[model samples]
Target: MRKWFGQSLRLGLAPDGLALVRTSIWPHERARLLAQARFKENNVEAALREAERMLADHEREGWALRVVLSDELVRLWQVAPPPGAARMADLEAACALRYRALFGASPAGWQVRADWSATRPFLASAVPQALLAQLQQAAAGSGFRLVEVAPQFVAALNQHRSMRRPGAWFGVVHGGVLSVAAFDGALLAAVRTAPIPEGADRDWLEGHVAREALRVGLGRPERLQVCGPAPKAWASSAGRLKFACTLFEDELDPLWPDSARLAMTGRAP
Candidate 1:
């Protein structure tokens, strides 16, 4: 059996601390939540000290700690590592500290927009692509499916479009997050996902969307739409990205279950 735990943080280069949202996944009722929580509760300093202890006692329990860091942490990760030596496990541990400090939990899977500065490295690295492919495989192997990478803003736009509301304009949804901004033909108060995948950056997309949001006079977006996998992680993005509405987990999951199902039957969530 496979066990998963995840958390997200909305961090930045600026003085303002990063924002975060986090959660863990288990075999529904199979795994012991308390055990998972105990393992996750370890701090970097504490984690290092308890490493052997954890490995000896809980390693066999089955658990994976996944974290979604904001842009700031990504920067730290690059320069934070000591020049001499750093283990992969150490890097992951530091990442855990950064993520935990911001969001108070660890994120298993993450979805970030194209604009965030932190996302740049991830986009360039093999990690995200691997994660994407791995996610597909995991879903297939586990019989789960991953849905569209639609943002909350796009969900609102779709909803608005269906209602036949006026003042509707162009919309884009990436990674289950939303960015709905009213286009007044003069300015756009657009909002988008911020707590993107660590190292994943939307170089050109960030400026492009923000400018468009301003140009269109993006006003307060309607409702926050929740659809597809990692909806909770999407919610964590909202705290930092500042979306107009929030999506309900139950609603989104039923409507758009994990797309991994396409690869495997009866294995989707």
Candidate 2:
């Protein structure tokens, strides 16, 4: 028989800190915050070293790790497969070429990953290879397996995609940055991110959406869906882009930064 489901751990990497969530997948999906740490210099290498120490005493021999990286750590863009493209290589080559054109740098230093497609446009992401190697080393040193690494924006979309409707915009906010995946009807058109400035309110959200819509040259959506740490005052949605925001991991999520500070050195609070 094929082994389909097993243990899994989620490592959330942000600009300032990191969060580790372990999930039991065999019986049912139950997640518990394992350990979270803040980087001394807000660097992935520093964060990874801290993470290794946190998991030094934990025993997870057969568990797999899923890393969710913040958008700032990655260069994200849309890739359209060239006409007459048929093989997987064609799609990958297209992504690589697009990456070079957009970032003006070779992808050799970055690990390019994407939802490969030949018929429609797909999102592509490139992460620093050195950061990836550190993440892999941390997992191996902790006696866990590093299975997958993905951008938090993409991961959020995959999780709540069924809730999204045609032409609706989706956003994920984390670490004071908002990552948007704009869709023209059912097809994703553009991906962009901007930092959420301090003291901004509901009107700021609307203005930002309007600017992004114009930037992408797409009509404004009639609906929007947002997930992550959103301002509470924006709950009363009477603005141009008003929508109910959903916070995943409602209880533990709000305390994300604090969780990282408090749950250090293998201590859970």
Per-candidate local distance difference test = 0.30, 0.72
lDDT of 1 by residue, 1-269 (tens): 42333311110111121111112333343212111111233233332223223223332222332222212222211113323324555444444555456556553454322211321111111123433453344323423333432222333343444433344333323333323343443222232333334433333334444555566455433333333233343333434443332333332223221221111111123
Model 2, 190-253: lDDT tens per residue?
A: 8988999998787787788889999999987766677676776555445434444333334344
User: What are the clashing pairs of model 2?
Assistant: none
Off by over 4 Å in 1: 1-28, 34-43, 48-52, 61-219, 225-244, 250-268
Clashes of 2: 0
* Stretches of candidate 2 exceeding 4 Å from the true structure: 1-8, 25-30, 236-253, 258-269
TM-score of each: 0.25, 0.83
Looking at model 1, residue 84 earns an lDDT score of 35
lDDT of 1 at 32: 20
